[model samples]
Target: MVDAVARLLRRGLPVTLAAVDPVLLELRGVLARAVDPGDEASRIAALDGTLRGLLARFPDARYAAAARALFGLPPATPGMNLTARRALAAERAGHEVHHFRKRVEPRLIATLTAELLADADRFTHAPLIAPRLAPVSARQPVLADPFAWEVAEQEEQLSLLWSAIYAARAELLAVERLISLRAERTDIVRAAVTAAWRWAGARAEAISYTTAFAPDLTIDELVALAGWTPPLTPGQTSRLTEAAAGGVAREQFVAHLHGETVLDDTWTTGLLAALQSTEPTSPEQPGAGGSSTAVPADPDQNG
Candidate 1:
């Protein structure tokens, strides 16, 4: 199934990403189950989203680059013939096309197949959360049904939590960029950036860290621990160095972590809105609700 889809994508898009195509005929069952039974546009969006999500989400950087290039996905240039795609993949990943064909290609197909099947299975279990979490806020409330007012209150809290997490992540990526630009400079300026990185990372990775390592720990416990720990003062590089050096090396580590973090754990509107579009902003990124720090009105818009 995945192989057929990849071949279709390689042939290229508008055709590949079109609302309807003879190419999707063989994959109809799985695609139907994986997405909400809807018009052509919504299904296509879900399909494209799933493909990009899976491709961008490799724990291995080389594998991700190769897979994205091979599939004509983002972070990879979108249009290329088979030969050109293979060459681009080789260049980006530093792995020869022969090795990619022998090793990476097969693995990527297998992973894609598994994820697609899992999505189908998840749809089979859709009564669990899918409808409740649908992106329907533009019409009616997504959380709880029209009748469930009591449950709506709890869902509102979840929405607020989702908004907070989204804001923190946008800020965290901002800090990540700042630290990256000054990575070569080990000055007090770097120290300030690092401080912001730590603070932002703490919030952005909170769900991951807590879910993975410390589910039993409480917010108060974390606050007490923070109070007891030494201050992250100027000239302090130890924290950053340890974080960067301990695992997958700096660049790959950040790439992998950031990839994993671009998710909506709360299944709210904020994340989908952020993902739909991005605009160039000079001062800083926009936060949840499309608010930005010191952002000016669009020059194209009237007051």
Candidate 2:
């Protein structure tokens, strides 16, 4: 009987009518039997199995819609099974005896509805489903109800909408992270550039101090004026000494002193040389002894 009903449903009978009619007839027949009380249990189990099989096979939007309609039927408190009776007896004296209507049946229906809806959406939108299956036009109408198909399509649309929302959110987060990284790099570069500039200026002044017989100069004063840290490593110190001795200009010397890692050594060296070579005062006497200090006009003004 279960197999017969399943075959009919697969052949596309209206599910509600097909399920209810046969089940009612079977129950009526079981009740009419006078000899065996246990016969009713077998009949009820068969009906229950049939209902479950139907739900399992047609877990889709159309089936769910049909099931939802079925749930609206007048509530019928069928005779309790032995298991239900035992469970009710085991309940504590003050506790309520849980019934199908109060505790389990409604929840079961709701769960079935939800599962059907979810499965319907999953099958409809699945990329693997539509392309591999025969086109609706070529297949017999027996398996292809447009109303059922539309519910599945709507589920697919919802899936696509959620995917789009998630994709957009992911893109926005990526863009935000990119912007933050760019800002951090920019700040680091700016600090590096400023440090390089000041180091170059100080080195130029240091070279002047060493070469000229001017007032004694402190390393602290040189660093403060130049706005840079002196190279601490021996390799860097050697490089600066070599460049200074090679007649590298004040700007170049300053850049070299600032350290190669912080600045572009070649460009900084070139800039320093340009500044030093174009000085208005002679290199032989930057400030002469006991005489009025001669101030060279601003290099920008001269330019």
Q: Candidate 2 at 162: error in angstroms?
A: 65
Model 2 global lDDT (CA atoms, 0 to 1): 0.37
Q: For residues 102-189, could you state the per-residue lDDT of candidate 2 as single tens digits?
A: 5543444555545434534443443222111224756433337887776665555434333333333343333334433443323333
Where is model 1 more than 4 Å wrong at Cα? 12-37, 74-76, 95-99, 115-158, 161-303
lDDT of each: 0.45, 0.37
User: What's the C-alpha lDDT at position 112 in model 2?
Assistant: 55
Candidate 1 lDDT by residue in tens digits, 99-215: 877776777767766766665665454322212245655666545555577466555544443443444345445433444443421232223333333433343344343445447
| Model 1 CA RMSD to the hidden true structure, in angstroms | 15.5
Q: Kindly provide the TM-score of model 2 when superposed on the true structure, using C-alpha atoms.
A: 0.19
